[model samples]
Target: MQAAQTQRKFRGKNKAPKWKKPDDGHVSVMVLPLAITDPADLARIKRLFGSMWSIKRAVQRDARAKVDAYWTAFHEREEHGAKVVRQRLGLNREALERCAYKHLDASGHLKHHVSKALAMHMAAEVWNGVQWHLFADATGKRHGRPKTGRWHDFTRIPGRARSHTTDRKWETFRLVGTLHGHKMAYTDGGQYTVQQPRRMRVPAAPSGPVLTGKTLASGKTGTRKATWWDHTGPLAVVFAGGPDSGRGDLVLPVRIPQQPGQWARVEHFLSNPGRWHKVDLVRRRKASAPGGWVYEAHLMILGPGYTAPAVRERREQAAALDRIGGVDGNVSNVSVASFPASLDPADGAPASTEITLSPEERALLEREAKKRRGRARALERSRRATNTAQYGPSKKQARRAEQRAAKGLKPKAVTVPGGARAARVDGVPKQAFRRDQLSVNYREQRARQAEHAASMAEHHRFRARQVAREIIAAHGPVLVVEDCDIRTWYRLWGKRLSQTTPGLLIAALDRECQAAGGRLVRASTWSTALSQHCLCGERVKKTLRDREHKCIECGLAGKRDLVSATLAAFVRFTDVDDPKAAYLDTTSSRHAQIVFAQGLEEALRESTAPSQTTVRGAGHAAVPRQRRETSAPRTAGRRPRATLDEPRPVRDHAGKPGQRPGCDPQLTLW
Candidate 1:
């Protein structure tokens, strides 16, 4: 009877659908705090982590020792047969396990899965070392033995490398448990509760009914209502169970940090249950927060779905017919120009801008450097003071004490510079805490400096992106940029590299272009040769000292960079070949251009400018013929005679003396 009633309700055309289909949604992890109501449990958790860290350290040490021993043996008997070498140095997996497994099994409290995971992580590191050595032997090794003291050698690499041990005390634990619906449990007595969170959707008002625009005419307008719905995710946080529960079981309840309305949504999700996914354990390490081990449960639930935004395809449309904006990214600043082709060439000039660090930012950097210097000075002074307080006895006093001991006489009292407490006699003193506190202060100060620098860089990048968007919007949708190598600039200009980050700016522009239904065209840096004029299909080369391009052939005069930008736009939208092709110097590979997006060939045919023609057989490609000769008539073209040293004519291999060795005698080489 209930199914018949529902079918009867949807029988007519005006009937409403039973349900709406939803789109697929994405998953994200939500971080939440764990509630630890018992101090004893917290202590146990701390002890557990400490023991795990010790085991991790031991594993790392054993792996490194094995790697060092294996490498030493390989180096000693590199000429021996493979079988003999394998026998001499037992470097197989079984041998390694035999050496390291004993230590892992000795720890009774360490879980078996935890030990296995830790061993795998350490073995991965050892494998990486082996791979590095193999690569070094292949590439770094020249002649016979490998290069010992080269700059790229691993041993010669600068900076300290830490293995296993780190400042952060957190470890990622793989879940070994069974999950069912909203409830989960582990063999080791660990458990957690899971649920879905909620979020507000678009076209939603805080709390009200939807309104029509007609009410505004009567001066009684109101906003539309916003919709609230359940938000589903893959990761559900697991918190330690609250106190006053069962003492024998080890289980944690789901405690999410969210608004009250979200809490209600979670409760609804919990009531309905869902499919189990995965669970991850993370130990919170924040000094200010309540400390406890937290678990993140991954689950899938049936609820409202979501669809990702569509990515616009790259195409030429009416939207691309706007003015062009060309950006020249330099080491110290960026120059941008947005203009129409109809605009006067004389009026076209790029505007340059740069970011300068504020006084406060600079002060923070200086303060960090000063603190480090002061710490070094203080440590040196403390070392001297400690030596004076602990060992200030004279040579005669020391000899008299020894002589008195031999004669069984009482020794005189010795004086110290400061006090006995100033030196470490038995163990570390309370005053040692001051040094540790100083070290922490230094670290915090350094962190603050780094944070400030990062903020400044982000601010500059945001500003540049904003300016690029505005220019593209006002002028045209087509963005032209030069590909830059920021690393090269960092090496050549050092600190000045901060003022310009071409890659970051270009990436930001790409996103803005995609959002605006436009496209970003990255031209070759060799387009810099555009600074030279192309007259009669010939390029005129000039030195860097030349700021202005004065082409005598075409009588064209303009600023170098402006001409380069114009030529860049022309080369992009047309099929004009680069005139620098004949003169490209390949000796230094550093300045080579990295290829990027090229303009469409169809756009070239649509252009009004005349296309260039290639004169293949012409001599002296760089110099124009009109300049090469003034007295000679235009029709009289001369060809240079080939020297004897040039390749001889190809003879027939069938005992034909007149023919050269490689080619047919009838064939004429161009």
Candidate 2:
């Protein structure tokens, strides 16, 4: 509890204090370029970094070997004795660090502090690999210890030495890792002061004081020239052309390689030196720029903290609940039902909107999908060709090749042909070549493919999430949806069709619903029977191919999807006994018009007589009203039965049975 309190005090009220005012939860990156024009210095800077990278890679290789040996022993050991085996084999950070020291000591290329830093770095790498292997084993993604490879490209050099600069006055200020040294400025006519380093001890301080753009009153904060880091360190870096002094307060004596106006930004950083930290001097070669090699100093800037205003919301407040809306997530789209601010629950109706992927969006998706598949297929083919050439063919392939040769034709190259075990070269499998012989081009292609796949998947997910947000905006808090078996559907349909289904879309909708101060309720998949039943509890069975629902029991006929949607709303929000009242309760005026229009069309079609109809009593006069009233009240909306005088059969769908008139029997459904 005491530790917690101390942490709170250091972190302020919301978070760690920032150096800049009105700080947001974002980090701003700034790159400062140093003007180094000397050819010899540029070459030396590149060599320094290159050598550092080489040393780090050497550490990586040694660590990898230790990891491999540990895994080998782990597999050979019993599960109960695994920990003991690890300890005895010394598969830990200390062991790896000692191994790194051995390599560095033999090379004698770096200083003691630098060597210790490199050892710690190697130990950290081994530790990360071991942790990941354990995690993978727990998740069942990997069977045993996981294999690791050397993929490190950049060498990390530590900043801010602790042992040095204790009780220093500059340390009291929030100094961004600045080194105290002589200040160098650009001499006029595109030249700088050149000084050579001597073996003898230097003087206590330089005779002259520092002078730069910060001293000048009128200087722009932004610049128009290129620059880079000229010097970097795991240890202290002394400048060759700097003040050899004691008690010098000046930090970062910079030399401008070009005209004065270009480096105003660099001078600004130096003016308030305490705000920056973890400075790195980075060197790069750019053929496009005029300079053969460029240097840039990269450092993190500190900023001020931000505290959000207090918010107090009452649950019963009319304004808050009034703004919420209802959402309906379906297989291919999302629908929103929004109520007005002044809408009363007893007499109110909701306005609705639907979201769907536009045609252009779908077309672009198709094009990208095609491109991804093509890339995957090309990669697979290349892998197969390379494997076949290196490992030779199997028995089935060899037979085929012989047949082809007999027919005076060239045989196709096939990798791992059927019914043949992998060939062994000196007791090692020929396929082992795959591990070490992967071409650079192949690796590059795989990386590009992985990146593209990630990008496209993210883009699709973002678009879906955005649509979900819009749905919540249109609708108020409560969301009602029917649970679907998406995995089952994917299995029944093809994977491509599954992609069009609302699996991810529904998830996005749920997220947006929560974000908009609402909740989602999932009804059972049994509720989907709405497509086959009327709101009045009458059953109308529909086949998989049916697109329309015609309920002979209650005369509720319309497009199957719309009917299901209306019934779902009714079941959830209104009485099922009286479909008229339920429809009015759940549907908006515009939606009612559409439902009524379809009903009217169905009624008109039903009332019309077929081209030929059989009537049992055509010769007899129409039944009397009194008789009809007494005899079962003549089912309303029913077609007349055949009479004795007119004994002809009624036909539909060009004289076929069970087909309705004025409707195509072969209309596509989904």
Candidate 3:
């Protein structure tokens, strides 16, 4: 039987996986609130959670120690490098798991709090973090080292499975409930006759008792008999042993939403013939709750289904277009330009669109950000007030002391000095500070700040989705964007990038494109300088302040971002996987030239034209041109000299003769 079971497992592993296409299947999460009003039950649940947290902490501690030991051994070796460390340590998932398990077993009494299965799960989580840190270090990527989690950090614990025939089933955590339906009936001889053991319709509402097992009976007053309805019970999340053990199981009644739409959605998902996965117990802090926390169970369901109707329809429409587009993402906005599959630019000018947050949205986000900043500042003040000895003097206080010293007045004591310590290599403060004493107000402020941040993130995500959907709906699914490092943008324009969130929007677009049976192609930034070059095959270098693209070679001028996006539409790559081999298909440049001209003309008109309605955000307004010196007379081979009425360009600050003022001297004309 064991050999047959092993063979069956092998066959199952060899079988083809499902959901090869996005439309083939979908995964949805249903969050059901766990209602535990009884004090004893809540206490038991908290105890179980505490045990899980302890187990996780122990495992993480052990994993960190093991990583440190490996690093020490690697450094002690004759040859020490990423390759040598990998070869000597044999660092992989399996190896990390083995080490984690060894360290877990060595921690006395730590394994007894949870079952072997749960212990292994916690160890696997630790291995995940360790693997991330190790791989990042090996690849020379910036990543923080894995650290032990605190009590508040432990928010979730996953169950093994809903049910399994094998012993591997986590019998501790199980859902107990069933939805009963009315018996099917048919009219026979002008009378209704009930069909035995057949349900007609299940209850639409998740709550309320459901009646079943109706039978036909000959009664004095009626032809049918009434049956008792069974009530759906709570979820049994057991730990270590069964509920009959010393530590009883944590039983919390499931609370489903009563709203019509929500109930309908829940009913639909439950009624679907989808594979039931494991449930996860998640805890969230709520200041208004009884114990400042609320527990919820997340049900994972995977089956055949599509997303929202509107999104699905948009994707369908996008798939039929078969258009190719290019996206030029900036710190404040993103410009998109696309051409149809047929390269006939004569058909029409390429579709061009600009995406940016409107005034209302920006104002709303700014208000929330301001609130969050205030909350953060309040939290910091509370912390410093509560734990005066833990912090040192601020820079302002030090400066004030210096000013006092410069004068004849004595310097006042600002903050209690922390104990001095040895200097470190990482540039951290060489002082031994005491642990902060967190006050209730501080915790409340911190929680408020965190909640505000979460709200802002959700709002940003929603806006990004809307923008992505709009782009896909108009320009088709296939897109090409420059392979520029978003991190560099963050470093350069951190605040602006945070507000606009161009990276998030790009990610959303990529997801939408993939779901619509298309892809987001990344063209090499170095090879195809979309911003630096024009469609006329001329390299035109411009400063950051130069928002207008004016090509002296071809006299093609337009908005810088729009021009770049248009050029990106014609970009081609030798290898799609390798963006470094990107090039422009200049053969069809003439076709796009008309499109560019039309687009530029429209942009110029918009910039120069007076607007009747108020424009918000970055509107197409005229940019001020710098005046330069053009007193020299016109030569035979040279271009026409600027007249007295024409604006003169400013000379270079470096006093270079016969050189353009605004142009960078380091760059050569090509």
Candidate 4:
């Protein structure tokens, strides 16, 4: 009834349908478009892109060889052809790229004459561009026209590699066919700019001033809400520079104190740097249009009381010099781009926690960044554009233009059923990451480490086992390590073998016991009777202070503490002994069938001596008849239980109930 009520509550007025459907409303999906502005900065981006693009030909050529080599290496195949290719040419990534690039260009551009020369130079002959131009053809005459085909500049656009440039961008340079790196390049600050396709996507709603006449469609709202930015990433920062920027290097000095009384290397550091530091920042302002009041902030170290310029400068210089060189020299990641309020100057304190920008603020920053990038790109395109109005094109040129345009067409994609799923449009984002100290090749690396550990473990086990075997062989068949773990026992003394140690000595004693007409057994876990308690009526097996077994059964008594030990020692040389095994017989050889029966009193007499006086004051301890087990003598190959006096119940001095085992000639439980 309770469950039914719960079901009713869950269903409310509407019952769940058999189809089992849910109608949580769907969320609208948004796609973020990435944009770059600040045309000057485009060069740095281009260089990064160019460096990537240059590998096309080399990549494609080397790609096939690399694939084949990978297969060869992976499968350990040694066929002659596979071996020859892998060993000789498959690993040569650079040469393959050049060949592929040259071939692709020739096929694409139909530069027949240049292909032959390219092929010649690619053959590993010592020749530069000038040397190639001077080389004679088959007719022993200089080619004269030199390169009918231009060499790839690797540092340009639309090209394969991470950085190949297409003819559209490449042809914009004045020295289209020159080998110099600076034919059509211009510099802005530390970055460079070059001609790019004017058709590159234009900005839709740029920040600052609106340049284009393109209007926002009537149906569009005041502004499409900007994409919420995740300020989780480092700030997108850029140092400003223009055509008028000067090209001078800044020198930061550091000093090192020499040993003893020697002069320090302060002067040398002023000239040569050990590290780099950014001494400028972007200033903040509320009114400069979109750039909004911003300028570079120069930095300097101020000394206490404004005194000791030389001393302070020296200290600052020494610190700066200590940190120059080796690093990439980029300070944008540091929080210097946002100033004044951002000037949150170095507190010279410990590193702080992360900072965050609200969704709205982050969006604004991104929008501003995009706008700046768009303008920079637009300026670059305008300066480097060529053949814009090439009214009449030669038939050859027309064909080339067609091919270049065709190269830009997108490729068709193949989609498989249920192959892989795209990420969900609405879901909690995955966590951000910090630099976690971890092995790069984790699976393989960990496996290797574990294997090494296991190997060490096995080595230790083997040494321990060997030591145990040697002890057993020398002393007797049965070995006993008295106090320590077996593995530790041998590991420490494995190198310098020992025989007198408890573990080793026990092992040896076992062998001797086994050699005689007895078996060696470990007595390590044996316990001795400590105190006495009552069994049934009023009888108690009392243990007087400093006395042992005070049993009244045989009118016999001795130090009870020594009884269990003596029994343990007997068991050590015998295979089995307990209350039932009082007369038990054991032999290393199967042929020795012997047995003996003796009452506790007689056995104690034999074990001790004839005239040993028994201690007084201890009560006559009576161990019960039923609890008393006596082992029987053996007949030829058969072992039998030996019986003793009838068991009489005893009670402790306190009258608590308990039972005690005594000698029973019936040798069943050992």
Candidate 5:
């Protein structure tokens, strides 16, 4: 099948933007490896490399766990959650719903466009495993989803079909039995083969003679003064004097054809482009003195200009003569001036910077969470199908009468020397009692093995097992948290989401803190999902619906629900927990390391000399800049935000997300 046509443009000489159209000769049709086929061995991939081929075994990363997708999810999900939070805050429902997904559905179209672009571009570096396919519709209009009864496997995941018919079989090579490195017919009537040879591929058009921009008589030819653009596109013809490079002067009118390929011969003859050649100033000595005249360089171009013929037949003849490099149509328009200036680079701007779950965390969420679970369930059904195939009745076994009628067989009892009893299998005679009759069982035995083998082969790969994940996080009161969040009430009870969200911190706890006998907790009013007490936005973990929850009412505070139940739900625990760690670390151990590094910069800055301390502090009474905001004396620990969704983000003078767009100018000033 043909791969997706994904291109990378080389615009002049700059890195092309992710989705912008690029200049020629720099694009590729690409797709995610996993999106195409199951994982393969390194040797096979290397063999496919076969010289000149790129062996980029990349792991496709999902957009959600990366930068933009994470922020988008938060904004979208909380926009939905804000309706209830607004209700609690004494705000009207319509105001909140206006920003909700239901009202802002058009944004989902932009989202789909962006997602399509991202899926086509921005692939990961090779060496990463392929990303699993995860289909998520933000418009999400589906209802009454049904569980499929048939068996499936990873190899059968639906995908945008890769059709081989789309490929342009531009040419064939004699040595390789492949088209673009794939098996295809050779140019000659013989079997093609691959051999060890490397060569650079220069871009070539399939038809007619072409022009390469070069200097004829040393006017200008350094990519700036001359280039090709014709054939129904724009056309410009100009003569140049002096050397082609650096500050060349233009001469009078030059000939350009009204049609494509008419002036190709003249263009080729004039552009004597020798490889690796460059333009440089030539020096000439005066006849009377030894010193050289800088401007006295030789110009091989004939400066004579011709008048245009008024008749069509003569014009056509002139064009034909020009095609023979005769210069018969070098008509005079007007004398040209100096060449134009080169296009310069634009001033660079600071690109967006965002952070979310690390690769490990994201892998667990996108691929490990749902897709892996899907494959597991599919395998479960597959295994059942295999069991049925291996042990279930065949048509021959189902009806003895039918088998007899088909074979027209009435099995005659045979008594050998040992008198062993035997029955014919589908009219195939079995061994009559000994190793002497081994050849008799071959056909029946082969059929049985073939049936069993076909049924069980699907399970001989990385199948999923039960996987569970939890994230536990804390936030400010009147603030919000989100996504696959794991809330712990007791040591064991919890709630988790199917995927990642602002609640990922809470969800993280399932893997990190749950082993200490903590239970995930959730509000009894909700199923630990997006709801009133959950995603609906409330801080009911400390205050109930009746508790007129004011900041300083009684100065009383406590967790309203157990923490364990919160951890279990939002995690989208397809299975109970991930099978990866189980497979890697053995069933008994599940631990990941957290390393600590000392911050020497802050340490050195803090330990600056006492005289330098003036820069650090206004006066002796001034507190350290690194000091935290002091808390007020209270009867209980301060609670998190009332709900996981809150309006607006913290604004700092520096900038949102701590990026100081204005701070860079000061750096140059410094």
Candidate 6:
């Protein structure tokens, strides 16, 4: 009946309602740890999660099987792909859910583990995954087929909104100031009252009809009445009674830090005008925790209308308002150049900077990676040692061993992959090997590797954000960057790109720019060709090995990335939505030549030794060797035949000292 009313209400509307984007400066998530220390309570929560996971897995498996069946039948008939099969069978999200209900719930498989509400929720989630595999997005990119989820992947259980007798909202979870005292009673029948902190106060219940006003198509105002709940304080995850009647709903206190700064942020977010939509209970593995797992509640608050005052002030500052920046992101480093927004040639030379991992940072990352690799190798060895029958000699190795036996020769030990010896294997390799008997050491090493990877990823994100903030602070929020695909660079420089994630840096820059009330304009790499052009408007093609942009047309010379960034400063898009329509502004480019030259000179003067700097690539201008004047005139005598203590001259890869390969040495400046 309620669904029919909703349909009738929207019958005359031209378009359906769409969800608002979260990052549009309104929605925010507050992550609070769940305090579940009681052993019985913890056991109950784990059991609840296990049930949810079982239901979710069943739904996902059934949905995938349905999709595969449809795809196979369609292909057999007309050779259609998955996407086409989905369209032909009308396998939309609703269709998938209906199928799941008919196959799983109606057949009594899902209800055996969870309630109907929870079962439907899991089915809807599975539909989302199936849709990703069976559909092409607006950009024509189809996601890879969904794989069977492992137990660890099913860590989150989503909760629904609060329930009202008059409204249709179902309350799978609720927030209260305290759990029932009976739930915490001891064996001796003594009960204790658990008082929550004042900061964690629950909102008062609604007193009257809640009406949200809106503008209708007739230009008149209308109000929609609805029930909104405040999801703060201790969370109670309600579960229906199973075979165990003693077990009840699981209640966990939300742990808000008492620290002033953190409390203030939480206070601001909660006190602001917003509606708490839902909460997600997430469980994560922690080696140091009591049970090897920790739980957190991610509360999704809508329209919080919260922004840090410092960020707003920074965006409104004179420096951020008057400057425009450009970024040239490479595999190992990022080059940034900022010019005045006015684009006047008379403005002082542009400020330029290069960002890269410091030597200490590089060493730390390398050490962590080395440790992870060692752990991985140890894990592989443990697998092979525990399950020897599964990892026997390969086909070639077995054949060679048989041949040696027939020839009456002793078996020669040969090193195989994973540093194992072929002679150690007693039989040929199994076509289908299953590693079922893993050692405790293997599990420990796997946990350690996962921890290291998480820490490394966090470190990378921190460094990337730090670099972005520094750039935005020094230059401005407005930025122009070439829309080059970073994935292509991964194919060419996988190791370097992984160590220094330039894509993460660019994403950070874009996010910071957006947060500061400015935009990161993506100029088309195909159209602008920032790297192939000079600030003087000369197009000079160069190879990947040519790290220096030495244009013959205008005699402009600088490090390739720096020069590209300088040219990017002048790129402008005719259509902001269409990056392909981007072009370099000739007037700005002509005027920026002087600024680029001055900046290049300043960089060269302040640069360190050639080997230590990225600015002076191969064939770049070198600093002059300062010859000291000798006070004692006759002591020069063939320069004492150059002792071993003296430094060797800089050399190219070809062993030619003090000269560039395949180019005559030119001393235009020195």
Writing each residue's lDDT as its tens digit, candidate 3 over 1-670 gives 8887776332445344442323646766778777667777677667657766877776676667666766777555546566566545645555555554565477665454445566566666677777787765644784467798778778887676544233334434544443222111122322543232222121221344434344467333432232111223222233335322464434555555544334446555555422556677789877666666788887776654436555566578768776777889988777777766676544333556655555555676588678768877677677666666556666677778889999979878654433332346885644443355788867776666666567757766765665576567667788989988999988889987877677888898898889888999899988888889877787899988998989898887778887787778788888987889888876656566754455434432222111111112111211112111265432322312111111123334447765333431110000
Please tell me which model should have the higher TM-score, number 4 or number 6: 6
lDDT of each: 0.39, 0.44, 0.60, 0.27, 0.22, 0.60
Could you tell me every candidate's TM-score relative to the true structure? 0.41, 0.42, 0.68, 0.16, 0.17, 0.70
Q: Rank the candidates by TM-score, best first.
A: 6, 3, 2, 1, 5, 4
Write down the RMSD of all candidates, one decimal each.
Answer: 24.4, 19.7, 14.2, 39.5, 34.8, 13.0
Off by over 4 Å in 2: 1-367, 390-433, 439-441, 477-494, 501-503, 510-670
- For residues 194-278, could you state the per-residue lDDT of candidate 6 as single tens digits? 3344333223333455544555666665654432243332333333343333454455656654453454565664443225656
Indicate the residue-level lDDT of 343 in model 6: 61
Off by over 4 Å in 4: 1-58, 61-65, 73-85, 101-105, 110-670
Candidate scoring better on lDDT of 2 and 5 = 2
Candidate 6 residues lying further than 4 Å off, grouped into runs, are 1-25, 73-113, 162-170, 178-246, 272-274, 304-307, 345-348, 358-360, 393-434, 595-600, 603-670
For candidate 2, the TM-score is 0.42
The model with the greater TM-score, 1 or 5, is: 1
Q: Can you rank all candidates by lDDT, best first?
A: 6, 3, 2, 1, 4, 5
Tens-place lDDT per residue, model 1, 27-114, is: 3333333344456545644544454455545644565554566556765556775446544554444444444456667766554223
Error of 2 at 133 (Å): 8.6
* Ranking 1 against 6 by TM-score, winner: 6
Residue 286 displacement (Å), model 2: 18
Give RMSD (Å) of candidate 2 vs. truth.
Answer: 19.7
- Candidate 5, residue 247: Cα displacement in angstroms equals 45
The clash count of every prediction, one per candidate, is 8, 32, 7, 64, 88, 0
Which candidate leads the pack in TM-score? 6
